[model samples]
Target: MINISLKLAILAAGESVSLFYKEQLEYFFGDAVAITAYSIENGSVFSPKNEDVYLVTTVSFECNEDILKYIPKDKHIIIGDVTFKNSTINRLKEFPINTKALLVNSSPKMASETITLLYKKGVNNIQFFPYYPNSMETYSDIDIAITPGETRYIPNQITNILDIQNRVLDRNTLIEIATTIGCDYLLDTKRFTTYFDEISNGGIGIETLIEKNSILRQQISTITKSEGIGVIEFDVNEKIQSCNNLALNLLDEDRSNLLFKVVQNIVLKEGVQSSKKTKNIFQTIYKNKKEEQINLLFIPIIKNDNVAYTYCLIRKNKDMKRENEIEKEYLKRGHYSRYTFSDIITEDTRLIKTKEMAKKMAKMNAAILITGESGTGKELFAHSIHNASERRELPFVALNCAALNESILESELFGYEEGAFTGAKKGGKIGLFEIAHNGTIFLDEIEGMSQTLQLKLLRVLQEKEIIRVGGDKLISIDVRVIAATNENILSLVKEKKFRIDLYYRLNALPINILPLRERIGDLEILINYFKKNLDLNFIFTEKAKKLMFQYNWPGNIRELKNCMEYFCCLNERIIETTMLPEYIKENIDLKEDKNQSTDFLLILEILNILKKSEKNEKGIGRSYILKCLKETNFEISEAIIRRLLQDMNKKGYIISTVGRGGSKITQLGKEMANNK
Candidate 1:
């Protein structure tokens, strides 16, 4: 024999109905489970000792944050025996349309919500009355009184009484709850068996349950019939049981002929089957009026230790073309830019000037080129420009030019015909340029595009039209192009790597974004912006802020946002210098050698300063170097300059001395400056 002992607690907010529930629970699970009732208002005083305790809440709305503190989350279940009944509404409709009826509930909010639902369902004749402690005495004129099961008070004047609690629960309900919570004694009760049979065989509440199931089935049928994609269902015997209208149309067969047909008889050509047992996708030729190649996805739904049914999604082999086109419509709506010129959080003068120029360019319908290093908010600028432009109401479509290869990129930009390629969509696919008509198409990382694609893109910019990859017809498009590149496209054009014509076409309105290191003064504002958006209550210590300002953010704003997210994940209210990312903390030690480091900007600045000093005949001393740096708004310590001068002299870039003469540019330094 197995030993079983479980403790169960019933919590109610000072309601007398909890005693009835406790009595019922003891009658059912008294043999194996010990039952206890507690008023949640007084609080739970006893803690279980080496025993599993399950708590049941009598009221749904009573499970507030305060109550949750005293209870284990997984140990509690809320069971409010409040359910909608069609029979109750049907009985109400038998009275006159303008007949006055009273609806009452223990909670005012619940009563209001139920009244609203009833009104929406065309039950406008009812007057709602929430049963307060003694408010039932005022409503003596009501013809019918409706109350939830838990409400103990009802006026005697109302002749027609419909109690929902009496209809919702019975002996079967308690037995099912007991079985669900692992109290098996309730399952074997003779009264439970009798009640279960009575309920299942068209008893008092069976009609309501059947009506709910029928309505749910109707909804499922409507969904299956209206969906654009083909959906077919098969029974466990692998025979077609039901199919949607789209599936019937795709198969070119009537519902009567398709029903009950085995799946093997429908396919003419076989394809590879997936290794997984539950779901698989493979190519096959279906025998409709003729042989048609399509891709079929099989999904088996398991129930009751068997495959209850299998759902099959069918698509033509050419559907990949339409897949992205359909997804683009949804993406255009959900992923539209929520950014504008005002959204760029920066106060740096250079970035402000760039934004001002971009705002002016947003007024014109010309191809704009945004140039910056990676993560310098190039895409952000593109979004802002589109959101502020004349085409603000239309779609702002964006594509990463480097993400796709040549063949896919061409089709995605220009679109393709139905029979243009082996896997082209059934009805030809509309490309991004066509979808983005009268709007803007942002092509990020334009320098990564091949020279061949560059020539085609140039044609589109010049003619405002495109021809599909394998088609001869020209499709006119009116989209504004905004191209962004991290590389210097002018250098690429000069080297014959990028088309010069395309560069000129896209450079109608050029904008250059400054990197994060150049605008270090804006660090605090950006940090606060990120923290506010993430809704995290965190403050960076002064040392942490100072370290962040000194570090060179190679990844720019994106990296800083990621660092803030990391701090938020740590659940720390105060972010200190030691808690920062390893790279940011290490940057403090690297600051002394920054001038002598292999940073391209620092190296180029040293060479430019030396070359300029040579022209002035004022040798590049530490003071003169500092003066030149101050002129360009760069502040570096004398120690860093001394280290840079020593390293450059050793590397044959300059000749320096500790005495009055300072440093002079060497032949190699002059050569390096000229090359740069």
Candidate 2:
């Protein structure tokens, strides 16, 4: 006699049943509670004896049609038709409007309803009977029979009936019940149909994302073997129906074993469970069959057509670097300096053409200067030039001229003897230029070098040698010099801040790297290149692109990269204009440019007013501003207008408010003008 508080769901569907079952488990094992029930289905609760256990009834209706509609569709229903048993049919009648042939696939609902009604009829025959739990062998030989007199006995003819009831009881335990029982079976119409209108709808709990590492591992293995890179499709069950060889190789798993295994097993390891903090990339895909269809770029596989498999193609989009694959490359040990010319990202036509020129000059020991805005990848170009040259076999060293003071710069560039300065090595310290002998020395921000140090560098370049700081020993060295700067060295020379001789020596061949905004023609190519190579979906709306184009990017290429990363962190597909940072959105115009010949200043004023207003207010405000300008006949200079406003405010003829201060038709000013 287990005192189990079993939760029986009578009229629930499959999804509801699953939830109910989960709740029942928590209610039981979570609190050390127990449950025992005659029927787990909704609307079926029976009690023959009260032996340390309580009996509870719950009504559940499983119907392809509405329960209320089904109840009124039939008339003159049969009461206790035991032979006409079917799970889909509602046996008990709740409504008297109509009666149809009732579906009674099981005797549990019918018997419970009949026995309940018969109790009022003074028929307690079945209700009072004490049916004890017994083995299958014992139940197989037993049967229940009602004698003509006041008596009941187990008979041989009812052995199958007893066995069936016992089996149902065994399966009806609270923790062991199946979803199909509550979802499909025991749809008694009597209690359920009556209560259907009264029950309130409360939604189920949020579903959790389970780990799927094993599945991903298998997919990776398949992709690796496929030897191609392209998009692939998988069904809801993660079955690979059709995929190009490229997509298959991207997954790197055996296609045969990968499909059979669940995605959870491949991506998330079997034993090591994932925590809630772990992001489920495939959550939307697994949760819903429709609308949740995923669009992900398979690793190393470019997803050209999200719906179909395609041929393998190498990603030529340099700016569109994928974080995941890049992370993999970065984490590998001891490969920092191995990055070559192929790794530099640039879409600038001038830069591309400069790189070709650099390649030809790499054979010579000629000094070169790469000039660009900060983050225009000057050092990157320097590295590529060094790596492509004959000095590639030698160690390539680099130093930032702006990062250190003159003293430290000199010590760092040239070696020091024992006790040369404070904390000098006992033996000696090797300078960067000495160590870079027979190699390349990349001088970044050469424009920031001090005039005094520039003289020493010029001496080194001319003499092709160096002298130690403490020791006067002259050490002749062979090293190629590559200088880079974000500043205008010619202007620095004019200001006497930089040595003219040093500038000429280093600026032998000046190459300028263009800013990102100047290469707007390559924006789409760069964006798509990143989309194809990266596992993310970062599509830009037309409005978002307009916003991007409107700004004068002070940070240049670096700012654009940061903005892209920021939006990517938000996991957005179509980056809308609204999602941009405040500075970008506030300063830039996201609308299309009209070709009408308006003065730049007037246009700027119009744009500012439009931006300050909301979407609904923009049009009205623009009209007002245009009308005001037309009334004035555009005669007033903007400066004169400002002076007039100041005078008006000083005379108390107009009042201005903070946050949004603008000139208006002041009542006193208008009265004074009318009087005149």
lDDT score, residue 349, model 2? 53
Best of the candidates, lDDT = 1
Across 365-400, the per-residue lDDT of candidate 2 in tens digits comes to: 657888888976677788888888767766577889
TM-score of 1: 0.40
Task: Name model 1 segments beyond 4 Å from true.
Answer: 1-335, 590-676
Number of clashing residue pairs, candidate 2:
56
Global CA lDDT computed for model 2: 0.46
Candidate 2: minimum summed lDDT over ten consecutive residues — where? 202-211
Give one digit per residue, the lDDT tens place, for model 1 in 225-316: 43345767666667777888778777777888778886654351122122024333333445456566465655554333345555566666
Q: Each candidate: how many clashes?
A: 2, 56
lDDT of 1 at 574: 55
* Candidate 2, residue 298: how far the Cα is off, in Å: 48
The deviation in Å at residue 212 for candidate 2 is 55
